[model samples]
Target: MDKMDKDEPRWLNEAELNAWKAFNTLIIKLPAALDSQLRNNSGLSHFEYLVLAALSDAPQRALQMSTLAVLANGSLSRLSHVVKRLVKHGYVYRETAPGDGRCTLAVLTDQGYRKLAGSAPGHVEQVRSLVVDALEPEQIEQLRHISQQILHAMDPDLPCPDRR
Candidate 1:
């Protein structure tokens, strides 16, 4: 009800300011670091790796192309481009879904599975170095909670599946 408060800009307090800065830094830096490691060690970009990993976890190592785009947090166009590259590399194959003529499915081939198996160790190590090992166990739990909270705020309808 105070006119003075309404006219003044709402600014972050010290703790909020610090937290925002740290979060901003992570959003900027973490992807680049992961991308660098994947590119150097496996000749895969982080997005490609994410796409492959999502497929790897799917039942029968296959998923509808649209489902995959959602799982990989990519647009349909981006997924199409990535899938094309993967197909060229013999890592994946695409075909129409058996029961659904309109839906396309992306399947991981043996070669793709083997490639992923080979590259996984290095990628896991990089993840550990960059994230897991950087936090205490409790902090890791906090991070998971915080991340889920943010995701919920961003899109309440989005599913956040727990990895086994």
Candidate 2:
């Protein structure tokens, strides 16, 4: 007989349960470890580093705020707050779009560019050490596909970040 009652919901099988547990653990711990490294070495949080890195990669080091929010995988409100902090720190500036005044643009300052350049090596090293080096070549490809699948499921309309 099934342990679940007829009225109860379906639950994970043992194999599924184990995978879920490991996935959940990785989701929780990976960010913390990355965050600690960034905060300790660069005085930036992981998210902040992402925001800067995204902008740095943009043409003219500028992007529409909305686009940046998506690239940074954050809500507009959250991105706004981070941008405000970056502005205060003299790393970014916000301005209205030329023809589309309704659209706000985030421009990464030279300071921001320099900061990102300085931190990038450390960030890349951490990423390689913690994730890339840990995975076999086949596993790396699998990870990319799995991540994209999950991202597509979550928001099919959202553009893939790495496609740029």
Cα lDDT listed for each candidate: 0.92, 0.91
Candidate 1 lDDT, 1-164, residue by residue in tens? 69998999889999999999999999999999999998999999888898899999999999999999999999999999999999999999999999889999999999999888888999999999999999999999888888988998899888766621
Worst 10 residues of 2 by lDDT: 155-164
lDDT by residue (20-113, candidate 2, tens digit) is 9999999999999999999999998898999999999999889999999989989999999999999999899999988998999999999998
> What lDDT is obtained when candidate 1 is compared to the true structure?
0.92
What lDDT score goes with residue 101 in model 2? 86
Best by lDDT: 1
State residue 160's C-alpha deviation in candidate 2, in Å. Answer: 3.3
